[model samples]
Target: MSSTFSLKYMSRRVSCAFNLLQVCLVVAVLALLVTASPLFAENALNGAENTAEAETEAGVAAAEVIQAPALAAIAPAPAADEPLSPRMRAALGYVAQRYRVSADALRPIFHAVQSTSQELSLDPLLIVAVIGVESRFNPFSQSVMGAQGLMQVIPRFHKDKLPANAGKAPLLDPVTNVRVGSLALEEAIRRNGGLMEGLQQFAGATRDEDQTYATKVLSEKQRLEDAANRRLGRG
Candidate 1:
């Protein structure tokens, strides 16, 4: 056989082997992706669990923050997607999980809280904590005291605070409820001369003297912050 023909055959064999190797590598990669996809999905779906360690840290951080006299010193929650900070992501993840609600559903409310907190010089987490305590984020929640919506603002008492038109319908709207509820909370804090006093008045539990309502609200806010700090690995 000619040396040329022999060399050509040898070259063809190497080329074929290389092509087969490439095909095998591609197949292996595809198999890996297929097998690992569910884990990725679960990780995405269970993002709440990813921040569990933050809960404890969040508790301590939250406690410190609530006692600080001004919630505005704490980081502000994000209202927009484009500029979401790590803390905002953690807050959303934690609250969504804590309240047993979807991130999508929680977002607009968070945005409203952000806007209202900014407007009122109040901490956004405090508003979120209020929502958690009053309604667990249920936009349609109503109380026996005639309180309605996420913030549990009784329409009759807070008519002036409700969105224009003097109706209870606006109170049921999650965004509107958060905005108005936060305003109410801000006013309560102002009238009572402090955060604790304001919270007591807001809950109409001023006579209790134990300040249970304020403590619960502050604790809830602290948990959110701890979770956020933990998620950021600050915990």
Candidate 2:
């Protein structure tokens, strides 16, 4: 009986050792899974972020592709009856600021200048320069010698050059003045055979002291040309 009891106690001790070993193995496996959990979670988060970034980039590219043609279609076209180009407007503003002239008053006259220059086959800057020197754009200006208006055209001498439709427009009128003066200048150019000589004759500068008149007009013309060029973005 003593032998049987000792055998039983030994068997029970071996069973308890086995159960402890199994418990230790399970705890070790659980620890290993816990250690790898953060790594797996980090990898999943990184993958998700990369996918989101790619989607955002694709969305931006698609938006740009969709918007491109719409933006082009909405671009403004040049109008048929637009009175002034941006460059022309800039040129006018520059001249008006530099000369202290009323842009409102002088603006409409530029159209006339352009048309008249084309009709007369003359450089528009030359006429504008002469107007600057003659009356500083003052429509009511009159000289002691009876020269009147912006270009100071002498009414008595240039009466024949007046437009037939002028009717009773005075020499002080801007349109009639410029028309008559341009015609007179054209005739003077024809008679003298050159621009400088024609300008001198137009000024009636017989004395040597008046030699600077043509030079001043030409200088102003050069300034205006440069202003126009700058406005056109060619300077």
Question: How far out, in Å, is residue 134 in model 1?
Answer: 0.9
**Model 1 lDDT per residue over 17-73, tens place:** 999999999999999999999999999877867577678689889898887766655
lDDT of each: 0.84, 0.80
lDDT of 1: 0.84
RMSD of each: 20.6, 14.4
Clashing pairs in 2: none
Off by over 4 Å in 1: 1-85, 165-168
Best by lDDT, which number? 1
**TM-scores of all models?**
0.64, 0.60
